[model samples]
Target: MMKEQKDNLFILVKSLSKSEKRQFKLYVGRLGVNEDSKFLMLFNILDKLSVYDESVILKKGIVKKQQLSNLKAHLYKQILISLRLNPSHKNIRIQIREQLDFATILYHKGLYKQSLKILDKAKTLAITNEEKNIAYEIVELEKVIESQYITRSLSTRADELIAQAKDLSLQNVLASKLSNLSLELYGLFLKTGYVKNDTEHKRVTQYFYDRLPEYDLHKMGFREKLWLYKAHLWYSFLTLDFIACYKYASKWVALFYENKDMIILNPVFFLKGNHYLLEALFYLRHYKKFKETLFNLEEITKEKWFPLDDNNESLAFLYINNNKFNLHFIEGDFKQGLPLIDNVLKQLEKYKNRIDEHHVMVFYYKIASMYFGAGENEKCIVFLEKIINNKSLQMRADLLSFSRILNLVAHYEAGLDYNLDVLIKSTYKFLIKMEDLYDVQKEFIKFLRGLGDIYPQEVKAAFIELHKKLKQFEHDPYQSRAFLYLDIISWLESKIENKPIDVIIRNKFESQVLKTTFN
Candidate 1:
């Protein structure tokens, strides 16, 4: 019973769209013999079901107990065939494969000339699309056909096939290596986040160089360049170098634009590249480029040619909304960003199953920041509490540390100072455990711990002292990732200048606009 609920076909069926279900039925009905067949009945039964229950199937008498697995398997195969024929699933790779399948059928029928012609066209298509693995397969089939038949360039055909196969093989191998290195580096980033100190930086730097693959830029193709840029972007992220991130992420997105079709075919990567690019811009405080990139990405997604399946749609929501928050943050328009909260939360709920925990928490952090900037200290604590109370959030130690730190600040802002000392001690111990006690965190925590000692008249002096201490680390690369979460510099300036933090940040934003105008 449990196995039935967890079956792959059941999950696939549950994930199918209404149009897919309709097409599948028409496909099954195309054969008169299948009009009332057991497998079709099983598919119909499964289609209506939210959960797969073998007992329910048994109750329907779709098939005998001994033959149930066979019927389900047959139904699964038929559904996939229907999906393959669906227009939405047709892409360059699938089109080439279909042509190859036709050629194989022709070859089996002894029509060697026809088979060779189809293979020739498919090979060109595959090569043009960077489907080199398919290109290699097509070449092998051509070679096999050529060995049995006569052709105009028989003498040079063997040489041509050998050369094409060798070239495609090398490109495929390079693409695989770069892609693997990118995946491994991504794994490391997710596991440990950015380098915390000199030791971590040295270790990650050595690890990256050790696993990095060698390839000539002049000979690299779109796929190879895409993965290569991804590898560098991950390395830049791990090193906490926003400038390098912007550089590589720009290349990543540029690679897609060079072949706009790939933006449709590889929409997930396209969305992610833009997301990372916007993040880099945000970190570097380039509000203008961030807005432009985000706007351009949204326009691209709106195009009819964009391929937006369930997965792509979920990612679109994740990336587009994330940068939307970043735009608001950089512009210091927290209240203007308010309307996005309800819509984003609703979409987050809808896409929660597709999104991972880390991303969801990242959204919460941003929303909390939005509320914090808007002077909703109580609401800010509400969002921060979600992160604070989440015991399962063990990764992203910086997130955890800052959440605790933010919680302390929010509590103080709310005049919930009765438990401030306890919260401060608890946050201090947590930071110590995470080993994230850097200059900014230490200054903030020390000030909070001694907030009781500072008289009301001397509060401005205390803020000044801590602000001066944190200013030293503003440009410190090792400690800068912290500011990416909470803009301590602007927040401190708000206190020092006796204005709301949002006002200080907004003034800075206006200054940026003025700077751009003059430039």
Candidate 2:
């Protein structure tokens, strides 16, 4: 009685598309002896089951209890082999690895000349695609073959191999260091969010510069430059420098465009670079560039050449839709963005296995913000509650903190203020516990906490005062990151102006557009 989620064989079987399952069946029956095989029967049973029940599997009598594990393992391996042989999955990396495999087999069969020939071709393909690590492997294999098979050209070939290996090793080390630094910065951002104070800012700045590897830009290849830009992008994000983020993200995306073939070989990195660029633009409030970038990305992804495998498909959905939400926020057209909410939720479910919980919560938060902008306070509260109540979300303390703060605002707006005091206290406690209670959040909580004491006639003046107080931090280096999460200035303007939040935002957007157009 194993659960479906815990059973890898069941999950794999369930993950297969219709064509894949068909291929698996054909693969099993290719010899005309495996049609009624126990593994095939087990695969069929698992494929048809909605829940993985060991008892039901045993009752089917495909195999005895003691033999079931081995059969399941064999079935899993066979299904994977079939998938590997699928034409759709045969990308450049796979093709190169297949060549390497063929070369290795030939070398083991005492066919050194043929092995060297294949390795030479693979090494060229790998180097051209910036697959330096695999290219290094090919060179090592060639070195072994050359040393054992004495030939007239062995001296020059050995020197060439040694030089190539040295160059590739240096590039690989540089890329690895930069990628490691980028990942570490990203992890830090997820765990605790942007630098909260001067102390934190200095710490992050020091950490970034200390670990950043030294490399000559002119001598660097596409892969090294890509990782270099990625490292800088993450550092900029953690430091809340939107301008720097945009600069590096632009460089990252440009690198791909300059080497178009690399885009096909490294679609994931290409997608991420564009996504980060869009994010930086969104934060900088560069409306025109953001729209253009989003449009370009959407068009590229729609192209037939763009990889649409499950992983890339999920990422495209996540990045594109996440930015679509931002686009509505930018335009203050939350009502129009409402349609995207249902579509995104459905896709989220479809790609649930590929999308992580952190990203799902991010989508939820964006949806909640959209509802808030549209003045659907109750619906906003409903979505915010999802993030606030999620106990397992260990990342993005910033998101969780703001979710609670936004929840309080939505609850107050929805006239659920009977428990306002309780909600405010709990939110305050939560922020304090996360050590994320900055000036913006503190001022917000204090204003909400004092709302009960203000007379109805004085509420407008209170709103004005709060707006004035919070406006100072709108440009503050350390505190402005809070505004990125929740646009409190616009919300307060909506209150003071006695208009809908979306109206305030729309007016602001129009002014910015006109300013950009004129300037």
In model 1, the runs with Cα more than 4 Å from the true position are 1-11, 31-77, 105-112, 150-155, 388-394, 452-458
lDDT tens digits, residues 1-519, model 1?
Answer: 443346778878877899999988778777665567888788778888877788888999767899998888888898899999999899887999999999999999999999999999999998888888999999999999999997567879999999999999999998998889899988888777788799999998998889888889999999999999999999999998889999999999999988987886678889999998998998888877888999998998888889888889999999999999988898989989999999999999777557888889889888999999988889888888888888776557777788888888888877999989999999999888877787788888988999999899999888888888888887888877778788888888888898998888889899989998899
- What's the lDDT for all of these models? 0.87, 0.92
Q: Give the TM-score of candidate 1.
A: 0.88
Error of 1 at 9 (Å): 5.5
Candidate 2, run of 10 with poorest lDDT: 2-11
Q: What TM-score goes with each of the models?
A: 0.88, 0.97
Q: Which digits, one per residue and each the tens of the lDDT, describe model 2 over residues 100-179?
A: 99999999999998998999999999999999999999999988899988875877978998999999999999999999
